[model samples]
Target chain A: MNFLSFGHYHHDMCLVLHRSLQLDNNSMLSFTLAMRDGQAFDTVLSRAKSMGLAVREGRLLASAKPVARAFSIQDPDRHWIEIILEN
Target chain B: MSNSAFIPPNVLPPLLQKFAPLLKRKWFRELVLLWPTLTRRRFSNKTEDYGVFKPSLVGHFGQLAVYVQDIARSRIWYQKVAGLTHSRTSDPEPHPSKPGWTLRACYMSAKEHDECLVLLEERDPSGKMSVPSGMSFFHFALEVEGNRKEDVFAFAAQQKRDGFHLNYGPVQHNSEPPDGDGETGGNVACYLYDPDWHNVEFCGAMDTIENYRARYGDKKGSDRN
Candidate 1:
């Protein structure tokens, strides 16, 4: 429905959260966090699950795409938090 | 300030209609409505102060997700209108909303940055998304190439030349100055409508965010992603 960015908060993104709450209205789709080089993405993924987040690898809506060394977590806010290796 | 300045005679496509009402809202006017107040103005309390600390989420801001009626068509439109390029696409999958349809999506970026403007589309037999309100997302702003007022006008000029109408602006906007002199020191912004009727903005002079952060450094803290 609303988006906040680390670089700054100009609402770089927005998605309308419809009354039906259908997955269709997801606009501010995904926020990517690039880990420092050599920071095993698995460690982050593992820790995410420990924090009660559902972190996983797959092509599902909330899951990460097949981007290299990337994973996705369905955070409590229901936004897709994607972790990817810095190229 | 003719009526045509607000809504262009309905001569344009239906998508322009989607963008028209957004222009009428007071929030938009407040941003561009530089002080000296003919009437009261609303200011966004969002301050933008930040420290050099490495956050747990240590990555650049990424792209935004937008749903469209057609990915391929939308890609070309972004190119002509905003100069964004089609970068990559994810595999086509089942419609997350419609049971019988399949959907495909792609990313559009102005440069090779970590972020992108994603356009998601589904095959609709009805030629419409059928998703209640036309688009769930209201609008998103992208920093223009130069982040200057000239750049904003040049981009708007090019859009017009390319036949992509800017629903609003290319106008300079600023926040009320700390001294309250209304010196016009704010971001320059403009608004447009995508083919799918979603409002999109190409803005320059984005220091308003920095101004916000300076006044209010990362207050929400770890709660942010």
Candidate 2:
């Protein structure tokens, strides 16, 4: 069993990765990362593209009120990562 | 599984002790059934107050644990792409449920948040166990900041350049609970899929549950009906 950890310097956050033999590609869990603003959101989108990753961008409405702009990307395990900027 | 019935004599109240022996007799049991009638009489008296208990909860989002195929690839994708920081990894140990197997896992978190994401893996030397079919939960969400609309468009444009498409949203919705007791506020959100086909959502401007009562008064959805 091998593992690695990644730390975000600007924030007191970290993610740990573990290696296992069991492979279940189906997961019911999803998580979100809030960006500071549109700029921060764009930075992540650009970073994904620079890494040759695919990204999806769209708008979101709440009760018919346009309140956010967001994008989606997939991690290596096929989990959806949604990045949102509020209007 | 057994036809015989047994009652511990000590469990009967002192007043009912005299009747305990008679209970074993089928004919006496049929004629002496008073408990059901008493129970129905008590229940029919609606004037009596019967307090129900509910749990007190803070309603804070906590940690999520997930199983992944490849820990290293998923770790780099989350750290580099998702921008999550690495926390710690646990030493390999025997699987909690699977015998003769080993288990390992790692934890990750975002800035300023104690809530974490745990990735777990399991291995067996015989390779007899099959991968899990899916997780039980429907989905979990993370909130992000959104200020300007143009940034979202820019993000979409970037994705288009990278040959990707937004799976859903850029829509507004009523931030109302399904029970219809809370005040309906507005929220904007979108969706995407992760490596394991998990549905991830990005949302902004969510409503708080506190003001729903004041705004809607005592008229709950059930009351309206």
Candidate 3:
């Protein structure tokens, strides 16, 4: 599983921190996310909630620190949205 | 460090030098002409560097996101399997259809820093946002900074503790082993499986955090920034 093998993002960058995990021995790939703003986090979740989506774990914005914030959620299609608020 | 001199090929060893027209073969002459032409063609095109093709939309990426399912299960799994320590969570609130329906979510991150793991609630019924598409791009990396190699290894070890084994490089990570370069610090990273089977990789550049702090401390730092 090559890290750069990942398709790059144009308008937005994935800012790959490092290689996380390889799935299906190479079929699917998974990694974490660090969103830019808390508002971005809010906007994503709010839209999903508006679409009548099911909150996977009912856990969003689970933790907060002086410099950063961390939480986990799923997208409408079941993709995990790992939100991060770095100071 | 003296002027070294080397004799020329030991008097040109008696090898096949083909000094007559009989040595000229039709196929060999044709090959000689074709080689340089092909070599010229190989370097003539100006193809775009596909490697730099951005994955997200212009200004729309790092902004757009859709919700999915399996909240509670994903949360616990992320914490235990992804080395995430709880930071905070939102209080339960009413969901639209299931009035009086409570919506709860928590925030978690790695021990080395903050905002490493961000778990949100899917809240969608049809599950249209995050389906795993063969054409779809994978998730984001945490872009860790400082002591990156150490941090990545630690994260990997933690994943082992959580019982999530990878297929390559100890964590199924697909990249070179940590080199302790100051640029990325230590290519630290690990992976985990969310409840819905979405793969999540946590990683960071060695000195990214410190570089950021030094360059723009207190400035707004996001994917866009």
Candidate 4:
């Protein structure tokens, strides 16, 4: 078996992906990525749209105040991937 | 989120509270261990982390272990779809609990992170080895750098070429509402399943807990739900 390693992206963290024989939709809910700033966030969002990927935009609220601007997309496995930029 | 979640509340009743100190003593633990049946019952009644020593933690997300039907097939799938680099493969060894059985594992890591995803398989040609049914476990995620839009797009293209598809998202998600007092913040992400049907997530941007506190105020953001 060939092993592919993507260990160069970050120094302190590694993203681990797992697979089980049976599909338990609830096993993994979602994971998030913190953008460096709003510009980078908007750039990625725009790129996703250009690729024709379905994207949903919204605001993350706390105490009825919008705390962050965000968007989401689903993978083939039906897991939520949320991207956000702090306001 | 607030540090209050990490602080345990006074859940022990007064009667049991008195014995809590005794339970921590080595001698008392030894006494309980003397009776095998009682030892099992005693430990089972307690939480899994009870009485265990803990070292200072950096709170880093580490490796994930996945059981697969075919290590070779899964390895190729992960490499093509997730862009993980293959690190090493371990020699087959005897299964600890099963006689005449052997286990082999392959380790794969992301670009620069020390953490890895491990693939384990039973080296049985008879095909009687059991793979987990995907219950009792949730999905794991990989954090993509914000500037890696091309890389993310490349990954998506490869998946399409391989006849796989994104399960969902590139969508945004928020923390719980104020009434829930959950952590405040949000993220943009997408998801997919590996060959063995395990969910894999790739995310672009997320907020830190400190950022959450900054945006929502210390009190509202600190309380983790």
- Say which candidate scores most in TM-score: 1
User: How do the residues A1-87 of candidate 4 rate in per-residue lDDT, one tens digit apiece?
Assistant: 111122221122322233223443222223344465677777778877888877866521111113366776655655455566655
Q: Compose the digit string of candidate 4's lDDT tens values, residues B1-225.
A: 011112112122346434433433445545654685554542222111111133212223334556666778878877876678888777776643346766666778888653257676764545465453444244466766442444455555666677775655434333333211111124444566666556677764454434544544534211332
Q: Model 2 chain B — which ten-residue stretch has the worst lDDT?
A: B43-52
Give the DockQ (2 decimals) of all models.
0.32, 0.06, 0.08, 0.04
Interface RMSD of 3: 14.2
True contacts kept of 1: 0.37
Model 1, runs deviating above 4 Å: A1-47, A58-66, A75-77, B1-56, B87-91, B94-101, B123-135, B171-173, B176-186, B208-225
| Predicted model with the maximum lDDT | 1
Best by DockQ: 1
TM-score of 3: 0.36
> Which stretches of candidate 2 lie above 4 Å from their native place?
A1-87, B1-55, B124-132, B146-165, B175-185, B211-225
User: What does the i-RMS of model 2 come to?
Assistant: 19.0
Q: Which parts of model 4 have CA positions greater than 4 angstroms off?
A: A1-87, B1-56, B96-100, B123-127, B147-162, B175-185, B218-225
Task: Assess the local accuracy of residue B6 in candidate 1 as a C-alpha lDDT between 0 and 100.
Answer: 29
Task: Quote the chain B TM-score of every prediction.
Answer: 0.59, 0.54, 0.40, 0.59
Higher-scoring candidate on TM-score, 2 or 3: 2
Clashes of each: 10, 36, 74, 54
> Candidate 1 has which clashing residue pairs, if any?
A16-B136, A16-B137, B47-B212, B47-B213, B48-B212, B48-B213, B48-B214, B49-B213, B49-B214, B63-B116
- Interface RMSD of each candidate, angstroms, one decimal: 6.7, 19.0, 14.2, 18.4
